[model samples]
Target chain A: MVEQSEQYLLTAYRETGNLQLLGRLYEPYMPLVYGLCFKYYKDEAKSEDAVMQIFESLVAKLRVHEVSNFKSWLYTLARNHCLMDLRTESRVSTVDIEEHLVESDRLLHQQYEEPITEERLALMESCLEELNEEQQRCIRLFYLEQKCYKDVAAITGYDLNKVKSYIQNGKRNLKICMERKQE
Target chain B: MNNNYLIIRIQRYLNGELSREEMYELEREALDDPLLQDAIDGYRLQQRVSHRQLSLLQQRLADRITQQTKERHAFYFGWQRLGVAATACVLMVLVLVLLWMRNHPDPQRGEKEVQVELAVPQAVGIQALPITGMAFDAEPAQGWKAFNAYLAEHMGNELPKGEVLLAFTIDEQGRPAAIRDTEGAVAELLAEAKRLLDNGPTWKGNTGKIKLIFR
Candidate 1:
């Protein structure tokens, strides 16, 4: 897939002046972008809109989008666009976040063992049920939404270090719960 | 990435503290080390799961984007396409209005033939260097492949099956002065020619070529 993707990239860039290939190459990873937007705003409609706008401009400018990794470029494009949309709308005004993020996503070639099972996922869910509201939201914000620690801190009224502590602790507890369920 | 290095990298990566070299190094290490790979995998998995697991997100986004783009473009161009249904539209009227005034031409806006000068002059007075066959990729010359790849990267598109003809001027100093190619990227081809001309050890004359092609 990587080689084929590279072939497509080279062909797309070299054969046609169309920068639209960046969008096709990046379509599979839109979930990550949407997921991040949803995490911050908790609104699917706006998140979808943000993702759309990002790709629209992104594809048009693909000819000059100096990038080695397509994944990271897509990630950054979506993230930056999403953040910009968020600011222009001012809906996340209450959800004070610092440091506008724009980074690339790299497609992983190797498939690693997803040791997580249904039972483990269920246990993890239950662990989430047991956590305090702030901690759980932080877990989702930091881990799932790809929000920074400072953003998490601002969202949930936790300090910077406290945000990290909550995420680390949540993961630890989730692992422990899975281990216990296996036992 | 060993267990220790993997953990450190993950933390650093998340914090956005890792340099580009370190980021690349971490990525390569994660690719090879199964244990480190597992940890990074776990980290990403955890991130995804936490992101609320939305499917069909890309397609939906694309559709929405396509919609928004159409709307925005239409907003600006609404009146332009409003009355173009019949052949005798307002544009014909406007053109007739302008042509009638040609007898009484606007002295301020004189219709000077608007002769735009060409950017790259025609490659006159220079003989083309020769190649054996139509295929350029087949040629394994000293710097042909390098030049090909470099030009390919800059051109941002693949050259088609037809021969790409470029016309360029060579100065007295043997440097390529100007280049022009409508079918292919002019700049890229000129750069490739310049690179080859620079590195050639046993060169003969100084003048650049007109219509340098794969054929």
Candidate 2:
């Protein structure tokens, strides 16, 4: 739905060669791009500069590239541009963010609207209990009780970072256990 | 959801705008999307993205587009103006040439033939000289006939025997003032030609040259 408008703008810009149309298309993603750049550069000024630079590149790139998924394509473009820039500066250490993010296989790509069966629910409950005490507490509070990470940390008397890790580890363990049970 | 709405949610989440349901919703979705998860982690480290900076960047983009358009328009119109000026110059020259042609036709293309029968003497020893005037280059002078009659009437028996070219300009008083022999005629012939022209009839306003042939 929203993607249709983005595609319309892209088509309009390509046909008319209108920069304003491209600007309108790119404007909505500026914040996301800025945030991604901030993650890499870690400096407000540099990140802002990178955002504008990415936009400058996109003006030329979008014309030639067959971009079907604009959001993900732009994300990949921003990330690779930042990574290459860092590599040119010999700062390989900054690319250490990969492990902190979800690995490809661990991501649950299932649709949110998919129905949950009783068998899966029971399996998930059993997997939930197998986690260690802190993981269980953080996961239950953060997800089941609808508490934010900070609130879960405060309620559970753990460090905020500790609470985040516990919930992450707990979710990974739950997925592992659920897969094992299904097999 | 709209991209702006999603960005606002991300900002609120980072700022701990504790709409717990929204937080849960964002977290649940982030589970399936690695890009969103990474962005969330990045936002956590960076804190927040200011709307002010985003707007400033947008304004800069808009200004760049407008400035490029203005330069293109200026370039296109600059050539157009030069073309218009060149055409106007050509038109004005054409009109002046037309007006000039109407005021002065082709000067009869050749010299006007002076009536020699009136000026030349019919005597056996002396013959009348043809009088030529310079005014025929632009406008034919009306006083050439009168001047020819004056030259014929003033012919004394002691006429010079060679050609004497006299150049003179008409003075403000409507009379020839600077009458001088240009061809270095003999002293007597130069004096006689000068006398004949200095006392010749007045022209309203004309500078003329008349060649005198004495027989």
Best by TM-score: 2
Q: Can you give the DockQ of every candidate in the order shown?
A: 0.04, 0.28
| Residue range A1-183, candidate 2, lDDT tens digits | 878988898877777767788888888877778777877878778877888888888878877776676776777778878888888988775555554444344533442353689989998899898999999999899778878777787898999878877877788788779879989
**TM-scores for the candidates:** 0.32, 0.54
lDDT of 2 by residue, B62-83 (tens): 7867876897899999999999
- Residue A115 alpha-carbon offset, candidate 1, angstroms: 29
Error of 1 at A68 (Å): 1.7
Please give the RMSD to the true structure for each candidate, in Å: 34.1, 16.6
DockQ for candidate 2, please give it. Answer: 0.28
User: Can you tell me the CAPRI class of model 1?
Assistant: incorrect
What's the residue-level lDDT of A159 in candidate 2? Answer: 97
Give the per-residue lDDT of model 1 (tens digit) for B122-165: 21212233333333212223344444443333332343322335
Q: Docking quality tier of candidate 2?
A: acceptable
